[model samples]
Target: MNKKLIILLSGLISVGIYMFLPADKNVLKGLAILFFIAALWITEALPITVTALLVPIVAVMTGIFDVREALSYFAHPIIFLFLGGFGLAAALHKYNLDELFAGFIMKTAGSKMIFSVIGLFIATALISMWISNTATTAIMLPVALGLISKIKERNHTTEVFILLGVAFSANIGGIGTIIGSPPNAITAANLGLSFSEWLSIGIPFMLILFPIMVIVLYVILKPKFPDMAAIYTIKTQDVFCNKKSYAVVSIFGFTIILWLLSKPISTWLGIEKGFDSIIAVFAIVLLVLFRTIKWKEIENFADWGVLLLFGGGLVLSGILSETGASVYLAKLVETHLVNYGPFLLVLGAVTLMIFLTEVASNTASAAILVPIFLVLGQEIGHFPPYELALTVGIAASCAFMLPVATPPNALVFGTERIKLKEMMKVGFVLNIICALVISVVAYLIF
Candidate 1:
């Protein structure tokens, strides 16, 4: 059978099965919507964004959600938070701030293998924390490329491993805060927690995880470029010769500060609720108006498919919520699992999130799981709902194994130096380590 025909037939069969299930029709419809989403994600037939928009459209057409309710997710605060961050990232990229920063860090490390690893980890982590992981990899990849190009070795495998480390480091670093990853944003929005609250939890988690990740990477993949003295001879002046653009740096810095201080600022100013995204949007507008960023530059920035993926996931999640499918699923889990303590609950949630995220978009994983976990949290009564919610959020960002696992992995895979098996070899272990650590810490802290 032709691929398209097979996909269509499979979708129809899934939807047909759902239609006959002894459950709410809306629940059946929501499942059908989810099936289509999964097919689109796996096949990559359409842009993920287009696939994302399709969920709400399909849900509305199927009478699962009205048009207004279906489309409202596009205006969701989390979506805007992504948009605002993307806009700031665009401004920084245009000015080449990330490259300059990464170069400066590499230069300062002076080529000790351990120090180089630590510096690379810190730079990649900080950048990923603020920008999207994809962007962080794109910006830092060149620096890695530069380092590799200068150092010649008979066996290139070590270079490949280090480059892969850079990419994977971006993924690990993004786990530190709500804005650090799309799933984190989705989890926070679903639970009605403020961005600041999520960050308070995330920052500490990152502090603990960062060093552990560095040690693991070093032990698993030994550095091949061991001539620290020779590597240091490469001029820092050449790498960071492009002077920093103050205008761009100031604007980007201010935007982050504003996002971080949004709650305090809103409270002191007595603004109504939900002003973080508004402030973010406003900051982007001001940047454009003041020519801090040229409109053309903004237009030329990379189109992030995650946004559409997020939107589509939101629509599907909304349908699930509106139709009470999520509630129903949550009840089933609650009946069987509520007797488990908070630690087990956190572990279960994180494990499910990591496994699902490998197959689906991280945002989609969060969308499907957050509502169910929220219900489970209420029923379990040992820990607050936010704790479980945060675990799902962090787990969503923990996709380290496959190219399809996360955008950062895919971005690095394009370089062709790192083999899929190699990634799996390292990522499989990291996944287990991350899930265990996140669950244990989350239960303790929250």
Candidate 2:
């Protein structure tokens, strides 16, 4: 169907829900808007951002929120943090620092095929923590293919292993930091989690899952190793050989240090805590002022739509909270799902999120579900809500069973080297492993 038809159908379905669901006007409106946006997000009848932008519009129309309140979410500090993240990523790219670092990693991984795959996984995951999974995969794709080309044998086993390694590692790496993925930022924003706080969980989560991913892939794909000395032997320039590169590294490192210490820094300076976003914007200013990167060069790197989507998701969360929809939904879940036990409930939810993300945008999945999960977490009374939210956020990045599950997955599949079945074969195991890991870890940590 065309976009208009899908949108009209969505409106009709939401209207039907509004009319049939026995609830207060505010609750009805909130639910209606929720279903409408969820429909659009799942169908993708509209651009993800377009669907996000609709949240405030629908809210105003339904009297859930007024103009000022609805529009204010667009400027939420999380959005700026992500924007600053884009600036940093662009600076790294402009100075060739990212590629330089990636090269050094590949060179060190040695010529063994199995070792190279492990290196690619580690390198992609590390870079993904700092930038984006999508960009990290893009940057690493050529390197993977180059390694594949050097193999004297042409079996698809090693090819799929290497390519999928790049994709999976990118997704895993994004779980390491708040700015590493949109879902992480969404969770942090909702839970008031600082960068260092998230790092406490996220870094460990990435560190554990990436290795499990390697083990699972190694067993499933059982890739054959051949001498890859030709690829690894190439000489590369030093990453910090120049003054410009040095400047970018200093700014990047300084920004990370501040984010990691934002809370202590705030205490020391007598400023407000949770000022990581401010530090992020400040880093952007430093980059430009120092000429490490020009504003024009990196301005376009920010995913403006995703930023708007975050804003819209926040507005939607308001609708649910302000309208008491969250309370109602939490009660509904508690009444029906509480008997499943907290561990199982969380495991099932995390598993569902991973699979749901297979067919939906990970960000959209997080946007739609995190608020509900947050509310559910509070009502469930078994564990902390932020733990649930953290699990959901991390699960959002673990969809690997299909190409549409993530951009990195799709990017690798585009190479035509990996079959749908191959991705599913490997992704299915990883999905199960990750769901269990996230649920168990969140329960244990909190």
Candidate 3:
């Protein structure tokens, strides 16, 4: 059958099931909403943003939520977090800070083969943690290509391995905090945790995972090069083009200071409301006012499509909660798996997130899973639900295997140097390692 017919039939069948189900009508309605989200994600039948906007609109029209309340999801803190964060990244990019930093690191670490790869990976990861993974990948790909080109000219065997490391690190680094990836932020907001708290948890996890990842890449790839002394002797000026570098550095430095002080500023203002998003937005406004970025830059900064996806997911998840579908599904899972405890819950949620992200958008995966996990948390009552929910969020960003898995992976894949199987070989192992680490660390800490 044609795709449109399939989507129509699927929606009709879901609505029919909701209407006829022997359980609560609300539960059935919730299931229908979730099914709609999944079908949209799978089919790409409409623009993701339109689909997202439609979610809450449909929810209200179908009696799932009050119109005002449904529309409020558009202004949700998580949505603003994305807007402001992207804005900040755009400002930095306009000044060319990301490229400068990447080049500086490479220039500094060029003396050692192992340290150069490590530094490049760390820099890429740190950049991805703040910027959109796609933008980060785009910015870094040229530098990685440059390094590969130099190495290839010299007939070095290690160039390909280092290139792969750069690509993989970008994906892994985004797991470090809420702003690190869209899914992380969505999950954090859904759990009602402060952005700062999410960062505190995420930073340490990233720190721990970074070394493990570097070691794994080194061991698996076993890159080799000869006469490193000559490679290390290149002049810094030749490698580090100073194109708008200082402006990028200054803006980036200020942005970090502002992010670090956001919580304290909120406390000082004595505001208990939407403080994190407020701080982020304030930073962007200030940057624009200072001419660090232009109004046109701000327009290009925001990912309107992703923002809509987030809104739609929120509406769908909210409906699931309001309609009692989440609770019912939680009860079913609890009956079978509550005995497994928080460890298994964490593992299961993370695994599901990783797999779902490979096929569907990470933001959609988080939205689908968060409400159900929240319900499951309440049902079990033995361990914190937020831990599992957070794991799912972080893990959702762990899509490293395919071009569709993440933008960064796709960006690097386009270079044509890294094959699908090679990406998967590294990504699959990294996914398992990250899942295990997140599950253990989250359970222990939270």
Highest-scoring model, TM-score: 2
lDDT scores of the candidates, listed in order: 0.74, 0.87, 0.75
TM agreement with the true structure for every prediction: 0.90, 0.97, 0.91
Instruction: Give the alpha carbon lDDT tens digit for every residue of 1-446 in model 1.
Output: 46577568758876785878788776776666666666776555665667787788787788877889888888888777777777777877766677667656765876665466557667898888878888898878876766666665534666756677787778877877666788877777777666677778778888877777666666787666656432433343653454435666667777767767888998999975677778778767877876767767765663556766777777767777877777777778878877776688789889888877877778767766776777667666787866776688788887778889888889888998888888888778888888999998887777
Q: Runs in model 3 with CA error above 4 Å?
A: 152-160, 229-255
Quote the positional error of residue 428 for candidate 2 in Å: 1.5
RMSD to native, candidate 1: 2.9
RMSD of each: 2.9, 1.5, 2.9
> lDDT (0-100) at residue 242 of candidate 1?
42
Candidate 2 lDDT, 226-319, residue by residue in tens:
7555455433345555678888889999999999889989888887755888999999999999888888877678778889989988998888
lDDT of 3 by residue, 322-369 (tens): 888999999989899877877887788888888788887788788888
Q: Which of 1 and 3 is ahead in TM-score? A: 3
- Displacement of residue 350 (Cα, Å) in model 3 is 1.0
